[model samples]
Target: MYQLTLGQRAQPTSPCGTSTDLRGGPIPAQPAHPTRTASSPARVGRRRCRPPPTDGYEGRLVGSGLSGCRGGGGGRGGDGSDCIDALGRLLTRILRHMASELNLEMRTDGYVRVRDLLKLNLQTFAKIPLKSHTVDEIKEAVRRDNKQRFGLLEEDGELLIRANQGHTVTTVTSESLLKPILSADEVSVCVHGTYRKNLDSILHQGLKRMARLHVHFSSGLPTDGGVISGMRQSVNILIYLDVSKALQDGMKLYISDNKVILTEGFDGIVPVKSPISRRHLSPSSIREAKP
Candidate 1:
């Protein structure tokens, strides 16, 4: 039989009534996989539990901090670090790519019932062990995602979740993405931060999506910490977006729930003819921005 060692979690009070689907139809939460634990095995006729993968996958348990994980449950160090990070990665993949796989609408908002996500993680899509996580832990992982990738929704009192941006599926509309362009207008400038090494390529080829969808940009550099998510070493340059020009040119620019400005995709993987301002950010300048 399959073996599951993850600890138990208190199921949140799921309010009654089905949530409205993309078409406003009722879609209720009907979980395919019930919670399992090492102490309590599934029935003899049921599926056998496979032990968690021993590789780094088991090194971290992502959500709903359980008591039975490696490195003593889900704090910030040891397995906790690995667990949350894995959850982030796994969720990102699923959010950005699951529409076609799951037979979902292109712009259906990428809303997956929490229970369905857990079932998918435990069975279908997972290739590693340590995929176990509780709904609470999943929620925590969403909260911790640095790029503001995932967004939570409570529809008709039924909790639902979705990716904030970076969707290849066109089923979603700008209104569904929300935050409004008026909000985008309030920003003095939006910025894209990248390492200094890529400046030449970017200047020549422009910032390409490479894969997935959307060209991610930060609304602005924060006063503390590194601007945007991935910045290696201490040196990087900032590319200021011409938001007004982009909008005027009819480019479909969007702001992620996390305040990052993104485009559906750039033409020819190069920036628009829109006027973009550039600046050199030294190590000292970044340090000075910090509180």
Candidate 2:
């Protein structure tokens, strides 16, 4: 059984229909995993769960507000923190990468039925099974997510959930997943955060989407009041983009529902204009900083 433990929050919604695949066909029923009834003996003597290996993923729980977890019960923190964290990571993977592989019907706009998602037999590092997760628990997890990585929608009485951005599925078109920024003024400031180690390559080759679908940018600095998500707090380098310039150059820029600035980066390469090498500076400092 896969254990349930806290994992790195990964860096990175919709409506409609009776849980159908991208091709609009009904999803095959997933075989159910055996369940432990309330009378079952509790498994004990298991070692305390450890932090998951860093996968370069980013994001943080906004708060420890989860009241309970259904699968395997208590987490490492003994307060459902582990279970919620694990659930969030699992949701990210399935929604962003494995929808096709798992045969879970993901719509073109990147939404999957909440009921369909809860049917998978996945588990956490603590051996907590995901099948036991309640819709309320899943809802709570997404709500408390600091990055606002997921968006929830209710349609025709069915709950739908989706990742706001950072999708690898090519069929999930930007036109479907993101809202187009029609004017540069739609976003006041656009900045891409990175590390010093990547500065040289980025300065020369520009920022690439790498494995993800779009290059992410923030509308403001992490310290800025308007900033919610998009950039990680640990990034030491900040590359500010001229939104107007990019727009004028015929670049397509988009903003996720969570307020993340995203773009294809002018054919997978967003040429860097100037990179600021510090993180503590204010939003206005980017304008004053020299290359």
Per lDDT, the best of the predicted structures is 2
lDDT of each: 0.50, 0.66
Candidate 2 lDDT over 1-291, as tens digits, reads 011111111111122222433212223333233576774432211122233332311123225433335335335435566667767767777787778877889888999999998777666543456666678888977977888889999999999999988887775889899999989779877777776567678766778897678988887767676688887665556676767767887888999998999988667777754433333444445444422
Best by TM-score: 2
Off by over 4 Å in 1: 1-81, 102-107, 121-131, 169-175, 182-184, 222-235, 265-279, 286-291
The per-residue C-alpha lDDT of model 2 at residue 74 equals 39
- TM-scores of the models, in the order given: 0.59, 0.71
lDDT of 1 by residue, 1-291 (tens): 111011111122325435532211233443344566764322111111232233433435446264223432223344455455556656665666565675533335567666566655232212223235566767777888776678887778656678876665555665666455544456655555554456667665677765436666665555444344322122245555556666665666666666666665446253633233333344446433310
